[model samples]
Target: MNAENEDFVRRRQLQVQRELEDATRDEVVVEPETGRLPVCIESALPSKCIVSFDAHESEVNALCWSPSGRLLASGGGDRKVKLWTVLRGQHQCMGQYLGSNRAINSVTFDDEENLVLAADNDMASRVWGVSDFRLKRS
Candidate 1:
């Protein structure tokens, strides 16, 4: 590769590394009270969280199931948002978003489920493209 091309590649790599580092700088938290997730929740005991639920290690503040019910999104006190997809036999975590610098309080999917939106304690809101898990706007 030419020197100009190499320099461009190095700058791109550094940009990606910086973004990743920024994403990882979120606060850690411990579990809090249990509540019903805003989806097709099963009946629960007074004090139990569903075992297979995509629970955060800390408090979960918001949840939204896709329009087709094939995907689920959640945001929480852990400063992260996660996406779960339901297959024939199980729910799998397909992606985890750690770009929120503060606790997330609301999460929702667009009508077509092609995008996800979240609101954070920092008084900021963000939009992400579901297909590539990239930030579309903030």
Candidate 2:
């Protein structure tokens, strides 16, 4: 490789190394009174019950915990939305919605925990009933 190519490769390697080190470091310093809260690391394992759903063939793009913290909603690049229940360090897929023709990007639950909103690359936003998993139109 040329000098410029070697330099570029070295810089890229350094960046990758830094990212990997950061990913493995657990540098949580919680000082509640200081108002400086620590951010949760995505790769860190869940404390109690953890559930992973495989309904999506593509990457999971968004995830949200339910109001009661018992359920989790996951949207992905597979154009599907899935609901999971956490129990004893495992996640159980409770339901799925294949409403969008494109990848689902985001998901959120209403404060009452009765409704869920999902946004997708198809330029569509949908609301669904949590209890019956029925689509709600506005």
Candidate 3:
């Protein structure tokens, strides 16, 4: 064989040998700490449930906490967006915003917290006034 051909064969053989070694090597398994998350975010998250309540008639699809942390908005498969007031680890249903004919998929509050918006499977977006729970736009 030519010198170039011989050199190529030698390099190919070395590559195959390295591949075989890597394929047969034992992999080390690292165990994660039980009931713990990464340090960077663990402190920001609540460690346990504070309270629970029936937020919707059907499965809840979306949830958003108001900027003040006092109110929570939830969208559900029942085609409703409901708001809750949180105080002393207890929650009360403030009211519900209705309009969408299909299941709601997302809910959020505007930056000013004056309006709550929801997107639904009906291919529409709706906004409601936080003060009145009346539909503002859709």
Query: Which residue pairs collide in model 1, if any?
Result: none
Candidate 1 lDDT, tens digit per residue, 1-138? Answer: 699998998999999877766655644443346543433223322355333564687988998989999898989999989998867657788888778999999999999888999999999999998889998999
Off by over 4 Å in 1: 1-51, 87-89
Instruction: Check candidate 3 and list the clashing pairs.
Output: none
Against the true structure, candidate 2 has what lDDT? 0.82
Worst 10 residues of 2 by lDDT: 44-53
**lDDT by residue for model 3 (20-117), tens:** 67655645444475655443331222359988888888989999999988899999999999999989988889899998999999999988999999
- lDDT (tens digit, per residue) of candidate 2 on 106-125: 99999999898999887889
Candidate 2 shows a clash count of 1
Model 1 C-alpha RMSD to native? 16.2
> Which 10-residue span in candidate 1 carries the lowest summed lDDT?
36-45
Q: Cα deviation in Å at residue 38, candidate 1?
A: 22
TM-score of every candidate: 0.60, 0.63, 0.67
CA lDDT of each prediction against the hidden true structure = 0.83, 0.82, 0.87
What is the alpha-carbon lDDT for the whole of candidate 3?
A: 0.87
